[model samples]
Target chain A: MHPINRRDFLKVASFGGLVFASGLSGCASRAAKSEADEFYFVQLSDTHWGFQGAPNPDAKVTLPKAVAAVNALDPQPDFIVFTGDLTHTTDDPAERRRRLAEFKKIISELKVKDVRLMPGEHDASLDRGEAYKEFFGETHYSFDHKGVHFIALDNVSDPAARIGEEQLAWLKADLAKQAADARIVVLTHRPLFPLFPQWDWATKDGEQAIELLMPHRNVTVFYGHIHQEHHFKTAHIEHHSAKSLIFPLPAPGSQPKRAPIAWDPAQPYRGLGFREVEAEHDEYKLTEYPVVKA
Target chain B: MKRRTLLLGALAAAMGSARAEPEVIRIVARKFVFEPAEITLRVGVPVILELTAPEVAMGFDAPGLKLNTEIPPGKPVRLAFTPDRPGEFEFVCDVFCGSGHEDMGGVVKVLP
Candidate 1:
């Protein structure tokens, strides 16, 4: 919540080190100092509310506990974004709506007033996001906050795991409005690049989306379908995946099948948690925190 | 002249049989895989893919061949298409079936 100062600038610069180590340009430091745009947000993804099984026995309590965890943050987050998969998939239309309503009711308890929501394949693909839209307005949209342009994409709704042509055109038009050097953050459920297509980890038309975002100098993508902490890069655009609230999945192609890792009673909620992304100028400092610290 | 006429009639019958019936390939989809993951076909031959998902509703998406369809549980969905070119293509279960849905895909090889 505080503005970027010398200490924060140095902290960000230290990660890369080259640009600032040679000589801290006055122009760069001045831009970091003057702008009150420094802020951080919480990213909670893949809650899977209706999911019940061996992968996560404590599924009922996970979402609520996550809500309490986010509320306890010291400065709190500027906003909270639920990347996707708010609820598990279901064949029954009525049950699907029920899960969405219940999931919404639970997240409503979060202390953060600004909470953003999107749909994962589990929440949208079955019915083409019809039930999900009944609860959450639009599957894809864009907004701006504190000098950062945030774009929430809906790659899961189409079932084929594509962003669709209509949405792609919308993205192109939206990017045209922003400056070339704008700081943009993309939020979605599945990875835009083919992390592992065999496991449905990659979005079908995600390459086109990445191409659209390529022109922008500073662009960071945050997604959650893999249900683990995974990092990838397509050119300069960095893609970071958030941990799931319900269960953790195996590393991409680590095994023959893409099944959920069985829950370990000794370490309940081991790999389940959210993240805090602190933005300072074009640099982002990511802090990973456990759901309840094991 | 009678012998020549008979030969021409038999040739016409053979061509009709070749073009009238398409080859049927049955593929079973379950959990996170297709029964016959890898399939081979001849270019210009019409084929009908009989798809069925035993447990959940799954999708058959062969983007390379522009063939996409939904296979509901307990019911069979038939998709007919003719292989237009000689090359390898990929088909995947576009629907999210379970934890391993991402890996539910196979390659289609077409012979020239």
Candidate 2:
């Protein structure tokens, strides 16, 4: 084996922490004591239900396969969250609706109970998620679960997924309702901080959203857009991303353009699937399981 | 060095050439995305995408092609297919990473 550089090791460790464990050690142990709030959620991102292409010849079948894998999880997630890319195009309403209808069909095939969703640019591209709202709900909103404050934002509404003053204000009031010590978990289609602005990954007003979240004692954001599991911490808040259910993209800066990653036929279906985020109180652990774990 | 071996090799090459494919589009990957967002190739020819991602672990799924595949971090993936018709087919990342996902796409324009 080659020698692992400290930088790479730190990166690996950081990704391990984000992809698998909550960095704060104390919080991790704390979760063990509070079984009442011990809850888990499944992250399903970038389904792109209507997509068809060269990367895979069986995309139509694999999507449902991923959902089936999620449904087969042992403990069963309290709820399932779909981050974005529900469809492939932004301009075609008929395509969007057709894709969403297929999404609904596969989701209906889900053995799991509750499925929460946020719009990705592909789903909201044409009209800033106007159609998505009619199907899902408000673009951005909040809810509470077992003393945990959970908020979902609509950042992919515009070209840059601008959080805007309205959503920012809502986030502020939403956080104000917390007791200061309450652990907050946020969900959005885009990363809460600037991840890769060049690729339009960062929300234009993500900083404002981060500022709204900064006041909380324990803050973590779950998002999907990049198509892989990556996490970052800014201003004391942690931002974690989920993998897509459709195709995988190259990392930021590594390539000139972000497009569907192609694969060798012999070893196809290697790097895709769902992740399980389990937590209690301020601590959480995420582990991504490729669809075919064997 | 050997006359018999040379003749056999030449004959094999000829047979291969006779059945050679008319078209194939190749794709390359670096860190987190595809290199060519759009590719054009002759009709009825295979589109061979050379997929790659850096050391960071990631997976790949092509919903359109009915392909659910993974790109082992720090390696290469090559996908081949023949698009019988000409149009734009979209591919989205199946892995859960943030930022450039919805933007991750490519097109194959098969011309007559």
Candidate 3:
């Protein structure tokens, strides 16, 4: 783990980036020893591989371009996680499976060995995630990396956009084993809070899940579903939504409907991007990168 | 003035009678489509949508109409509302049923 030197810190700070670092501990001020524990993971979401529409004409190459971009990282991310929506929704079961398979094959090219995946409603809700599970293993699971406990919750599987009672129980049991101030990161496909319920931008029982995590002091949630980068907070827990790889959607309730913003001919892939989340203990620094360089 | 008051009372009574019973429409929700996908209704007329999911749990959400409900398997879920405006509104099976769930939506055309 290379310590971020003053030059590297200056370079990131010059870009007026790391907006998430606000109100949290300063990354530059931390001791080099503590920086040794700092590790970042790449988050790419809503690839919607099989999608073909006006929103993104280059859908076929977007995922591959993103994979190439991630592979170009100086020291590759500790791991890579696709928040959800691995494939476009399809009515045919065989086609759905094929899309998932194709999506998996594309991501396999990532240089990162430890790649984690979850499902968005598009990839799951149809068969209650039966096909998604066949490809991605489990819709929701947890793991530990460098003292940070990461929990991936599946809010898309139930179709009603719920984390469900069973998963809530699992979350409760999982949190019970952790300290109140334990560094925890939650990954989900839908916003756990009611960002825009009318547009289905909410998880039906997400409030219940939030209640379960409220007791913990150091909990941050990263999700992807709205297909654009958004930030919110439910008390102390900070929720950040990632941009989709395929296209972008209007801001929460900004429009009467939640349709994909039309692709721009001059500025292709304008609102599509991925993120790198650097975790130094409980504090995080998020840096966004466009799908393609400007 | 007395005649006008009598006429107003009769109009109120007629409106009351209209509200006494609402038109019921039954909609069946399957894997990826809603039966009777396009429905037409009159503005100011009260309607009760009897929604059912024959195979699995589903949802009826028409945000424009402010009607949303869960249609549990083997049970019918009824939602009642009066179309206040005249326009084409959309109601979708918000619950994930299968692969085509995203396209499982119907339009409710409320005639003025």
Candidate 4:
């Protein structure tokens, strides 16, 4: 198992060159500030809402905890992004709907301007993400915040783990709309580059998407599914994977089986956490906070 | 002599059917598609499908045959079954992958 590495700089940015001034010592109060200087957003992934039992006896509670945490942020994030895996997957369409609906209700408690959602395989795979799209929106899409372009691609919806030709074309066209120096952030459930094929950590055709973004010097990716914080770089693009809310998985290839690590009754939700990124100028700062039993 | 020769021919044919081994099919599932989307086999012949997913988790479901199994990343799952009759069966990736998950499918043709 490779240990987590914290080296180099973790930077966040918005279209307006927003940089979060809050460092490891987070803000204690939401003070009125210079809006032009920086902006921040929260990323909560792998909530696994409908999850029940062994791996997370309190699976239902963690998601609400995350929401409450976000709401309590001294300076509320401009928006919130739930990367994927909103609920546990089941073949029954009815069960899937119930889980999705319940998750929506829970997250509604957050106070944010906008909430961008994408599906992890668990929420999309069975019905080809129909439920997810119906509940959320397009599986792959993009929008601009301030001056940065954020593209959310649906790598989990494809069983083969590709972005598909149609989506790829869309991406090419989308990138063409922006300047070469435009700061771009990609959001998806699976890692865009092949992290570890054997563990579904990599997207099958993510390299093509990366190639399209290769021309752009400022590109960053935030994804979930690995259930742990990992940082990787391909070419000039930087990729970061977030921790899951339900349970954590072992490091890549650490165990013969890649199942979720059993919930530590003592630690409760130690390694399971969420991320907050603040962007200023060209520098992005990311901090991860784990869920603790209330 | 003619009768003995005819009897031996029939025995050889019977032995051939008895000793036939099951055909093996290796299936790999990626994001939106499965490799070798079409599989062909003879009716009444036992076949084994070895399934693997290079990334993520997927499921192969053929409701007609009551078959459903998960394809985990970097793991091999073996399934054994025989085509009962000559016909075409469609199997789809039951696991939710991404936008193309529904399109991830293959056809199995069993010949008489």
Misplaced by over 4 Å in model 1 are A1-35, B1-24, B28-58, B61-92, B97-112
Which is the leading candidate under TM-score?
3
Residue A187 of model 3, lDDT score: 93
lDDT per residue (tens digit) for residues B1-112 in model 2: 5999999999999999988864444454433466676666666766566666664433444444554445666677777777666655555444433334445655555577
Per-model TM values vs. the true structure: 0.77, 0.67, 0.81, 0.70
Off by over 4 Å in 3: A1-19, A22-33, B1-20, B25-47, B53-57, B62-66, B72-75, B80-91, B98-100, B103-112
TM-score for chain A in each prediction: 0.90, 0.89, 0.91, 0.88
Candidate 3 has an interface RMSD (Å) of 2.4
Per-residue lDDT for B49-73 in model 3, tens only? 9998989888888878888898999
- Name the 10 consecutive residues with the lowest summed lDDT in model 3 chain A: A1-10
Judging by DockQ, tell me the better candidate of 1 and 2. Answer: 1
Positional deviation of residue B93's Cα in model 1 after best superposition, in angstroms: 1.2
Cα error, residue A223 of model 4, in Å, equals: 0.3
lDDT of each: 0.83, 0.69, 0.84, 0.78
Please give the distance, in angstroms, between residue B55's alpha carbon in candidate 1 and its true position after superposition.
Answer: 12
Collision count for each candidate, in order: 5, 48, 4, 34
- Between prediction 1 and prediction 2, the one with superior TM-score is 1
The TM-score that candidate 1 achieves is: 0.77
Q: Write the per-residue lDDT of candidate 2 for residues A58-161, one digit (tens) a residue.
A: 67877788877877777788888888877766345776787787778778888776788888878885566777877777777787776567888888776435
| Positional deviation of residue A20's Cα in model 2 after best superposition, in angstroms | 1.2
DockQ: the better of candidates 3 and 4: 3
Steric clash pairs (candidate 1) = A198-B102, A198-B103, A199-B102, A199-B103, A200-B102
